[model samples]
Target: MKSKKIKIMILVIFIVLLFLSIGFYIHKHHQDISTDNAIIDGKTVVLSPKVQGYIKKINVEDNQKISAGDVIMEIDTTDYQVKVDHAQAALLTAKAAISAAQNNAIKAGITAPANVEVSKKKIDAAQATWEKAYADKQRMQMLINSGACSQEQFDQAVATEGSAKATLEQMQAELDASNAAPVIIAASQDTVEQLKAEEKQAKSDLAEAENNLQNTKIIAPMDGRITKRSVEVGSYVEPGTQLCSLVGLDLWITANFKENQLEGMHPGNKVDISVDAFPNLKLTGIVDSFQAGTGSYFSLFPAENATGNFVKTVQRLPVKITFDPLSPEDALLLGPGMSVIPTVHLNKGDV
Candidate 1:
């Protein structure tokens, strides 16, 4: 009886352990989150010229992958080169004017002292002549009144006195002009500054022209693949015109999840992803974050909840998830608009 009891007891213990293991497995699977079949994709970047010009050369082919800082196309740079030359000439002219203005200022400063001295000497000479002429006129007027001199002689003396007075006034004006010349020359300093400003503006124009010329050569902004080649040699492309598009290799998934299913979803959750195009391949990723609001909130026109009649709706929020880099041996290639399915394992870690 003891041997039979021992065998039954061992069987019962094994059954209890098996039930516990099955329950644990069910609980673990429940903690996981999953989604429907979606697409694997990347970001699309548009490649366009900064300035408008004719397409001179196209070095990249359609669907060709290129690295960052690679030259893709070139525009006709003749017009930009002419603009640079014009700016340079204007700058040189302004510089020459500045030099001439400086010389004029120096010469004006040098002549000031000599001009003042000459004016003073002229004023002294005019004063002496006026005194002599005034005395002679008074003597002649007295003689004419006493009948000792003729009226014609008195008239000649008066005319001499008037001429001397005019000469003295003219000398005084010369002295004033000499004193004011320095201030007049000082005002010309502004002209020098104006020329300098013009030169600076010309230099800036030259730099802008050089920048536009350099922009004629279209270069790759990032590591990407070129597509939709709408440009060719001799094509007259203008600014804002679509030449082609470059799709970046670095990509992340945007999963739209229903509002009700986002209770435990958070960043740092481990995600298992599979691409619809490649059924056998699997990718690992992490939940980056969630969008601030629903995708509909940023539509062409959002709903106005303040209206008298309103209807409640379920919204889908986009969740951003990043995938790890694929191994080189797999040779798996992905591009924009590819579909993917992402299953998030929420209970894998502390997150």
Candidate 2:
């Protein structure tokens, strides 16, 4: 009887311990959500040349850390410099042409109206002389018919009147020609305007040439480390040619959690991160945002559920978790594509 009681007591204790363990595990699962489908991600930029030229010099080595605005490489500037010089010369020539045209316009503005007025005055004087001569011819004719004037005198009067009339007509023609002064002025102004347009085009060309010259020097766009250096001292590269790449210092975590697991998840939820490569390192972050779509929805070949027999499948959504300020050493060590495990404390208050 004693042995049976001992065995029964041991059995009851074992059962109680198992139930307590099960209850603790269930409570912990409700409080936290964890997934191993996460990795460190960051910004990456591929460097390319904007202008084509032979590489004259390279100032960066593979995996070299650099800051923004640092010169990474330089292309041959001989051709580009020549282009700039030619553009400058062309602009100067255009400006000279415009100056000459403007001078012609100014001369026309001053001289053309004066010629018109002079021609008008000459026409008025010639009209008066013709009228006087006509009256003299009429008087001579009357006297000659009455035998008071000589025939030679009458003939001289008639010739004088004819000469005066001819002079008046010539003066009228000169006035008509002078009236075209406005047209001449307009033509000169038009030439000035056309030359001015050419000058504007030349200025634009010069600006473009200067821009291309500046592009010859490749500079870092952000604070990063250079990698995949492919160009040598004399490598010929064209526009859009890959010169190298720069990996940015900014880092984040992308955690893919199952659809059912995201029921209580939200942005600003506290998270504990563990890097696979650094087992001893413990990092903290917060949920920044959720991706707009599931991974499969954005995949190259998404499932056509309507066409095939539909089988219910769990989908995963990517959650962006941004780290709290990391130490300088940790920032330098983390990079893109490193595997990580993240546990989100759903019950914990947000940081």
Candidate 3:
């Protein structure tokens, strides 16, 4: 009975030890889920021309590191320079015309129309004489009818009144003819306004021409390394044609972790990153943020959930990881597009 009991005890001890070992194994490595699908990412700027022209000079080579404001290339500026000169000439001509028009307008405005003023004075004097002669003729006619004055005197008064009316009418015709004098000033003012508009248009054209001339000199927008140069000397390129791409030196990682493993992985959690390029080189970083949606959702062709053979699949969410500054020894060893693996600590490191 003692031997059987001892054997039963030994079997029970073995089962307990096995369970403890399995529990310890799960406790470690379970919290730190890793993925190899992650990669180093950075900003890439594509270089293009704003104005079309033949490539006259190229100052950079493929994969050359360049700084901001550096002259990248020069387009054949002959056409652009000519355009600028033409625009300048046009602007000068417009300004000169405006000056002449303004002078003419001012002259018209300052000088009152003399013809109208002269005609008005003459008409006034004639009207006064006509009124006087008409009154005298009426008085003489009444006197002759009443036999107070001779018929001859009344007839003389009537002739004098007729002559006065004829003179007044002739002078009135001159006044009517002078009414068109004000129209000259109005026409001059209109010409000035027209010249001003043309001047404005010419100024705008000049500005555009100068802008195109400046665009002929292509300059770097930022400090980056140039890659995939597509232009050579004498190559004709148009606006928006991709000349090359500039990749920034700053780098970060985008790690996509499975949905089930994201329970404890949050932003600010410490992470250990390893690039596949240099297996032994390990880097430290922290989780910055989680992407708003899964990578597949933002892809060119997103999956339709209501398809006939739809089956639920676990989605991996991308997490942006910003790395700590590397020592001088490791600074130049990595770049974008390199495969990386990252492990999240789950626990935010001690404060």
Candidate 4:
């Protein structure tokens, strides 16, 4: 009878302990939200050429690590260099034309005023000569009428007066032409301005040519690894041709958790991550944000639930988790698309 009682008491204690363990596990599971649908994500850049050319050199191989501003490829510059030279020659020609026009303008400016002054002086001299000749003709006419001068002498004096008057009229016309100096100078200035405009156009062309030439060399945009290389040496490529892709070092995690598990989940919640690739390695991060919509909503073909066969389904929302400072070794091992499992601590006070 004693042996039977001892066995029953031991059974009772074991059952009680089993119940307590179950209750504790349930409480811990509720506090921590975990998801296996997670993967590493990061920025990716597609590299393409802006100008068309044959690939002359390639500085990087597939998966080669690089830094920002590193030259990754070179295009044959024969055609682009020729274009630059042609543009430079055109610019020089334009400058020479501008110089010639400016000199002509300067000459016109000085000659205009001087010509007007000289013409005015010539007109004054011709007028004075005409007046003197008129006086001589009048004196000769008087003398001839009083029979002191001969008719031939009077005729000579009259001809002299007529010649002087004609000279005076010619000088007046010359003065009028000289007064047009301003107009001539203005026309010359206009020519200079036109040449200047041409020079500006030539300068713009030269800049464009230089830019094309510079674009022949492809440079890395950021620190990344070369990936998906598609070009080889001597390969002909045009603008918008995809040469390669660069995968950036910046990374984050995308964890898709069920809607029911998001009750206490929020930004700043602590997370413990485990990468499938390195099973033994562990990582820590924080809940950064929640995606606005479920993953299915952003899919190419979303389901239309309003149709005939309507059935409610639980949705999974993507949560962004950012890593804490990673060690160099960890950084090397971690990469985009790697599978990971993350557990979020809903209580902020919990580690």
Candidate 5:
């Protein structure tokens, strides 16, 4: 009975020691980051046309791989081309008007100087003739006083001097009128400004029309695969309408690890990925970072805990993990929403 009691006590002590050792080792050594289930996170872009038109051609098909700047589709550009032509015609008309206005300004600026020169020459000639006529009148008057000249000759000299003075006055009036700026002629500057404004407007219209025409031919902005193609040839699509969604090659994983499993989680830690779609393919990545809060915190309707009824729930934080570059063959099967299980090794010493 004594030996049996001793053996029983020894067995109970051994079991207690085993439990204590397990608890101590768990506290010191083991670390892991795991998620329930995750999908391959990838970038996607929506293709939208700026112009509304009938689809003329669909150059790409679903799942077609395209490069940057490649023309994926085209719309009937007849209307756009017509607009461009109209803009060009309007530009030509504006240019012609500008040329005519410039010529008018030049003519107006030169007319005043020419008239002033002619008036000056006439004034000089009139002065010379008046001087001669006055000398002749003096001679005739002196001859008449000595009874050597006729009265008619004296009167003729006086009339010639009067005529020269009248001519000078008329020329002066004409010169003043010519030198003064006319309202119609001075308005050429305003006309030029108006034409220039019209020309600028026409150029802008032309640019807009050309841009619209170019937009008719829809081009891919990035290298991606076409998906969710909705439009077909001869189908009418309006602006802001959905044409297709492009899935970009860049991909990452969003692992929602439990709060308890994130003790040693850090960025730059190595990770192993196993995708459900391509189980045979092994993907390697590194821990990018952890989001500040749970994914549900950013939901459209977040949980309102202000009410008196409250329940404590464990929140799962999202950890971003970025994958290394893989070849086309290896990455062909990976896509957005594809299931993946990521396991992060949190042992810094082992890394």
Candidate 6:
């Protein structure tokens, strides 16, 4: 009977010890963070058109996997091609105009200086003639005063001197007018510059037209799978219209854990993740980073804690978890917005 009593007492003690050990473990490891509020996230691209056009062909079906630069759709390029052709014609016309302007400039450059040189030569010739005629007239005047020449001869010499003087004056005026070579050159250069400016504008227009033509063939910007196809063959699409959503292969997890659970959690901590879609499959990751504020803080309309009496509630911090790059054999089918549960390992010794 004493032995039975001792066994009962020992059993009671063992139960108490077990409870104490469990409580101690709970207190020590309370910083372990776990949350079902997680999702698989990756690069999601919304494909759109830069130029508006009717869809000529849809090269891909829904959820079709494609690589970078793969043709996704072909927009009707007839209008764009016409624009490009018109631009090319305009560019050619501008170039022709430039050539004409250049020729005019060259001709003006030569003509202006040649006119000035010819005017200078004419002034020199006129000066020489005037000087000789005036000398003859003066000699004739002396001859007439001494009665050594006839009146008709003196009158002719005087008329010749006067005509030579008038010719010299006309030549000086011509020289002055033709010496404005700088002004003529400047006017010619201005024409050339105007033509060059027009050429530049034409080139720009041509480039824009070519760019639009290239945009008619829609190509995948990156390797991804297409979803939410909002377009079809023969359907007109406008610029900035949503055509599809592209899901990238590389993905990571976003986990929201309570504030109290952030005590021992840090970047580089290993995480055990389970996808809600595939309960049988398991994944592993490492903590990448934590958001600066709670999820509610970034919501569209955050709670106004300062406006009224506030009830304290546990706040959750968003944490980033990057999965190990999946090998070909272990690549699990996953995508963005998929639900996941993540448990962060709190041991300091692990990588």
Query: How many Å off is the CA of 45 in candidate 1?
Result: 2.4
Model 1 lDDT per residue over 1-351, tens place: 999999999999999999999888767644666666345557787777889888989999988989889999999999999998988898899899999987877777778767989999999999999999999999998999899999899999999999999999999999999998779578667677888898898889889988998899888889888999998899998877788999887888888878877766789888998888788888899999999999899889987889879888888888888887767433236776777889987653343
When summed lDDT is taken over every stretch of 10 residues in candidate 4, the lowest stretch is 342-351
Candidate 5: tens digits of C-alpha lDDT, residues 24-52: 77755655666756778888989988999
What C-alpha lDDT values do all the predictions have? 0.84, 0.93, 0.87, 0.93, 0.86, 0.89
lDDT of 1: 0.84
lDDT of 3 by residue, 123-238 (tens): 99999989999999999988988999998899999999999999899999988877765787888889989988999999999999999999988888888788889889999999
In terms of TM-score, how similar is model 3 to the real structure? 0.75
Q: Rank by lDDT, highest first.
A: 4, 2, 6, 3, 5, 1
73, model 6: CA deviation in Å? 1.5
RMSD of each: 4.4, 4.9, 7.3, 4.2, 6.1, 4.9
- Residue runs of model 3 more than 4 Å from their true location after superposition: 1-30, 121-177, 327-331, 348-351
Candidate 6, superposed: residue stretches over 4 Å from native? 1-32, 120-177, 327-332, 348-351
Candidate 1 backbone collisions, by pair? 38-339, 38-340, 39-338, 39-339, 39-340, 40-338, 40-339, 40-340
Q: Which consecutive 10 residues in model 2 have the weakest lDDT in total?
A: 342-351
On residues 1-351, what C-alpha lDDT tens digit does candidate 2 reach at each position? 999999999999999999999888767554789999999998899999999999999999998889999999999999999999999999999999999999999999998899899989998999999999999999999999999999999999999999999999999998898899999999999999999999999999999999999999999999988888888999999999999999998889999999988877888888999999999999999999999999999999998899567998999999999999999888877888999999988852221
User: Candidate 3's error at 239, in angstroms?
Assistant: 0.9
Poorest 10 consecutive residues by lDDT, candidate 5: 27-36
Task: Say which prediction, candidate 4 or candidate 5, comes out ahead on lDDT.
Answer: 4
Work out the TM-score per prediction.
0.79, 0.79, 0.75, 0.79, 0.75, 0.77
Q: Report lDDT (Cα) of residue 16, candidate 3.
A: 97
Which structure among the candidates has the greatest lDDT?
A: 4
Residue 78 Cα positional deviation in candidate 5, in Å, after optimal superposition: 1.5
